[model samples]
Target: MTESPASKPVPAREIISWAFYDFANSGYTTVVLTTIYSAYFVGVVAAELDSGEPGSATLLWTLAIAAANFIVLISGPIVGAIADFRASKKAFLFASSVACVAATALLSTVGPENVAFAVLLLTISSVAFTSGENLIAAFLPEIASNKNMGRISGYGWSLGYFGGLLTLGCCLAYINYATGRGLDATHYVPVCLLITAIVFAVTATPTFVWLRERATPQKLPPRKGYISAGFGHVLTTLSHARQLPDLFRFLLCIVLFQAGVATVVVTAAIFAQDVMQFDSQQLIILIMVVNLTAAVGAFLFGFAQDRFGSVNSLVAALLIWILAIAVALQASSEADIWITGNMIGLAMGATQAGGRALIGQLTPVSHNGEIFGLWGLANRTAAILGPISYGVINRLSGGDHQLSLISTLVFFVVGLLVLLTVKEQRGHAAAARAN
Candidate 1:
């Protein structure tokens, strides 16, 4: 007899391999989107465009991010559904990673005059990165039981922040070396992009080699193509929204909170540079501090998640986010920004780890991909909404990024309110019944 998913043994090797994917991919977000390339695009690339609007670079960058996330928003659920039906989550993950790595490496060719080129590459890589992210997350229910999902998920996230730190550290070292040699960003940023891609490729290799695909292929309906079948399955899952009330409710909450999270992820570097007058090295150091704290937060919160419940942990995290935003709004000196960034980092780590764990707990193994696809759908939707909203606010506020940041508070506050409505026990019970 085939083993039930819940009873299936997850080897330690597989868990490590799974976690390594997070380790590998964190570099992309850290180096490209959050630290090096984003600032390069705004300060150097888009500046060459000679756009009269002070916020044009920020707007363009957010548009690129939003555009990529929009693609993921449309395709992520379908991809997950297909991955579940075909038992090809790993294959899909590999494809997405390859695309991301390749596109990221090619970003080295872009120059100050290549605004459109830079945006195109950024969009492609972002799509691949987000898609792979969703695919990897689908592995959670298969590799972990509901009881310890928080701890295990926390392992991946904590490791991911460390990975980001490592990547940022390497890039910072290179930037310092290049700066010492009197090289401009146009000369050095490309190399940093290449470094991020190489690290991503090297670190992610273990996941492809060591991680096992545990999903069993489901029978397809006669005459239906995989794409159509995938859509049908997604629709069928959506049709049962009422049955999984808590899960759906939690997803709604994710949409709101993730908006705040997404805004911070894509725009924090921009804010640091534009508002705080932080140079490249100082900006990197600030982010590295955030990464270290974020790693610690994820590691500790994982245990807290298991002990205290996901909802409670998440509530605490969101409350911290609100507080961080308050601090950020009034931030004046480097000291104030440091405190705010650390607060944001701690809350970010706990929020991300807690949310993913809760979803894993609430999700049935049988539809891990499809359900997490919906989770991805929520995330991508937030990604699209959040950064774009921030950009719009920046534009409207005459390039005042500080004013734009207040919008993040709304997402967290409202999301927390909605989160209070989701009964955690009911969510777990619903998943058990579905299984």
Candidate 2:
């Protein structure tokens, strides 16, 4: 009898450490990027800007996001190639994570009137966060065996959601306590940002200590023009993409679908403040609920992927996203916010975890960094469009957030159609062979 791939076990400690990086970083995604800092930027920092400017705040925010995406688009492939060549994946991960932590901690000092400071800090932090995410993703192949990759990826995302959930809960409690005593809850934003940095730094420590890189570190050629090297890598990856049809298809799906996901993250705080009239405490609660629910969804979907298939799980997650967006568009009250938030939680975890698993199934270990770099570019560059769409629609419609949210559905539907054409099982088989 042949031993099944599913019967093999990965090192438990390494997997845990790798997943803990997600746990640590999720706090930044939750507190800074998604809820508190975004709201602070738009409502406080940007609000203080000169008056009579047409959509100036939204435009600045959009540009910041675009700049971050542009950096990722240019640098992701080079970083991936370097990771592969040097086999210094862990070192890369540590450096990027520390950058993120430092950037986030620096955000603590940006005051309400400090729009320039806020923009600079947030942009740097966003770049670091996304870059670190790409590095962390390269670790999956090291920790999980092929058969259990989907479940393991899901577990990591689930744990991340839980971490976000807990942090948001703490933030909410502090906000409520501050507000009740007639103190300023807004001041706590920086404090929370600092805590997020510390937590990420601490949680990510284990990954650096434990996870072993499979490839040997290579000596990079004497520093040529960095910009030229970056652009060359990007061009090569883009041209090479056509040679891998399945990977191209997967990249396309992720590019479109993830745009919607990224838009939701960037816009949720704005929606709550503008539409639902939520203060900081209420907004924190909403975020906490979503993260909690997403954690559960991640675990469940991970199990489902193992039992059924990653493609199937991903398809179902897209459908859920469509429904969640529709519900969010129609939400008029706090109760509606709760309902939609819960639905988002379920869909968000499945979308991220399942997507990673599917990508893992399609990529060769030797090319993991390069392919995942393309994946990062696709994910982040595609994100640039959604925010632009939302900002444009919001301005045109006089802040009609419902109409703005409808734009997201197009991404999900298109991605779903493209994904439906994919032969997932065959793709996975090919990926295994390439590995």
Candidate 3:
């Protein structure tokens, strides 16, 4: 028996499930990485140690983040390959989700006396969350039609921001109601993380149930040889990408631009607390404002992409980021920081959703997971550099945050230059042939 085609497109329930994972996972980004947990690490965990120590608690946090990025860089391609071969995207998602939940829940045990244990748990959770994101992201093109890909991607991002906003709000409420007069706000960080993990696990169930994996064209290799096969495929894909000038240019632009994006995200909370001296309430407000603006930006840019093309929309977003970061460097007051945060919110959603949609438009279907795995590698590897550069510059310049921010312009400028050389029409043609 053959399946019947419906007049109206089947509602993308599976796609929504895939997207909600972003929603579920974003709580971690907002509550743990960006605002609450970071503050806890620097303020509470690091406070126990001596000031101005070279290998102090702050250094350990930075090293842990770098380590997680490196692990993702190495493992992304192999995981993508395994998912593609086994048609096991959902399975991988489930496993990673569980890992994230377990690690995050464990974070609640971290305290002033157990700083090392806290960082260790956070590192594991961070790695798991990121790895899970890779699997969920790879499922996008399978569920979204080309015409609606940008819009769907926008919705996913919007939902993620909303999720972040919700979690941030809850944290703020908890702080207001529960904390005593003299208690450090940092003590509540682990509780927020634990809540985030529970929410992630609960919300992630629909995705596994609703999403169906598409069959992969590539044959499954023997279990003993799969690792070698995956690596071999990675090398082959890299060679092919080198030969395709447009693809090569796209990847280069992605690396540079995403580095800038990562820098903004990783540093936003730190910048607020350390440089602007924002309190927890103010930091939560700032995060919500940015997240709200990003939701708006994603919708606007997705519409613009449908009309003007992804490349044009992306270039426009990059220009906005350049201006935002420039303003961020000069921002001193809370008002100025809030304005900068809004601008970042505007650019963040567009840059990421548009870039991913562009890749979906450009890549050959047969190589979707492989190509996206490479894209993930570039993103993760770039993450390593962005934070390290920010930390080094911030530490070196007598803790001058502005100088560290100025470094981001290099990424945006270089990314724009490389993007101009790419041929979108050729990429579309390649995609058509693969289909």
Candidate 4:
């Protein structure tokens, strides 16, 4: 069932359904990872245990996120190989999606007294979210034409931002209601987490129902066990790095720059809270603007990547990230913070869409899950390194966020310099030959 370049045309219905999964999962990413619950984890949920110690809550939260990413990094390629061999991407997607939704909903029960429970649920949900992302992204090559891969990836991302906007809107509505009722707004966090889970469940229905499995199950290679085959393929791919230099090189760059990008995302609310003294509502508003601008960026840059090529498009976006963090480090006013956030949104949207599309372009549709597993490895590696580094820096600096912001600039610069070695067409050809 692995597709050549001439695979049958993908239905538009299926494509839209596939994109809706992005719309669904993004609520968790924005609401939990970047905005509301992240702040709650630090300022409220973990507040009791840490006894108001500097950086303790942030460190705990970072370690939980780091642990989740570490799990994904180790396991993604193996699961990806099995899914590819079995042509059971939908099955993997369903399991991970349910785990994520359940964990997200269960987060509602965690309060100040049970920081351990909150961290546990966060770790589970983060792993499920990332696992689902790897599988869903594997489908890109199945659905898109080479010419429109960037645009289609952008479509998914732009739509994802709108989902974030809608989820934030829901939180805003509830916060307003709570305030009018003379209630503490922060206590309403568990309820908002519940709302996020429901949104994801409702929106993701179309993906499970409409998206077709394009890759048929293949026989196990002679004498190979599932786990062995999985690890073997990954090792073989690595050994042949010279043959797939662009893909390998792209992964190297991803591990570096994505570390910087994810650090900014996970720390943005904290930075705003600590430096700008933003309340929950203000932080939510700021994230909403970032989501709005991110949608615009995805729409604009989706095609820009197609026209200019993924490597070039990604390089430009990384420059923006470098500039954004530099500005954030220097900013002293609310206006300056706003400017930095918007810049981050633009760069994040473009780089993510371009990076996914670039992988689609380089990989064969047949071995997609395995290759995208590599993508997952890079992504989660960044997830682990970025948050841990930021957490450590915050601890060392006694929560001095400006110093942490300044440190991320180096990741971007190094990643950009390394990215110059890739040759896109060669990677595409090599992947095709391997499949």
**TM-scores, each model vs. reference:** 0.98, 0.92, 0.93, 0.97
Candidate 1 regions with alpha-carbon error over 4 angstroms = 1-5, 49-51
**Residues 216-257, candidate 1, lDDT per residue (tens digit)?**
888899999999998999999998788899999999999999
Q: Write one digit per residue (lDDT tens) for candidate 3, span 186-293.
A: 556666777787777877777778877674446755674667877877887787764455766787898898888877776677778878898887888888889999
Q: Model 4, stretches more than 4 Å misplaced?
A: 49-52
**Model 2 has how many clashing residue pairs?**
2
What does candidate 2's lDDT look like per residue over 1-435, in tens digits? 111234445578878877887888899999887898888777777874425554456557767876787888778778887776667667777777888889889888878767788888888888888988888887676566667888899889999987787677767776777667787745777777877887778777787787666665544456755445545556766675545567778888998899899888988987888788898877887888788889998999998888888888889999998888888877877888888888888999998999888787787666777778888888887778778787777767766778888888888888889888878877866666655
Q: What number of clashing residue pairs does each candidate have, in the order they appear?
A: 0, 2, 0, 0
Error of 1 at 352 (Å): 1.1
Task: State the weakest 10-residue window (summed lDDT) of model 4.
Answer: 1-10
Indicate which candidate wins on TM-score: 1
Clashing pairs for predicted structure model 4, backbone only = none
Give the better candidate number (2 or 4) by TM-score.
Answer: 4
Error of 4 at 206 (Å): 0.7
Could you say which candidate leads in lDDT? 1
What lDDT score goes with residue 375 in model 4?
Answer: 95
Which candidate model has the greater lDDT, 1 or 3? 1
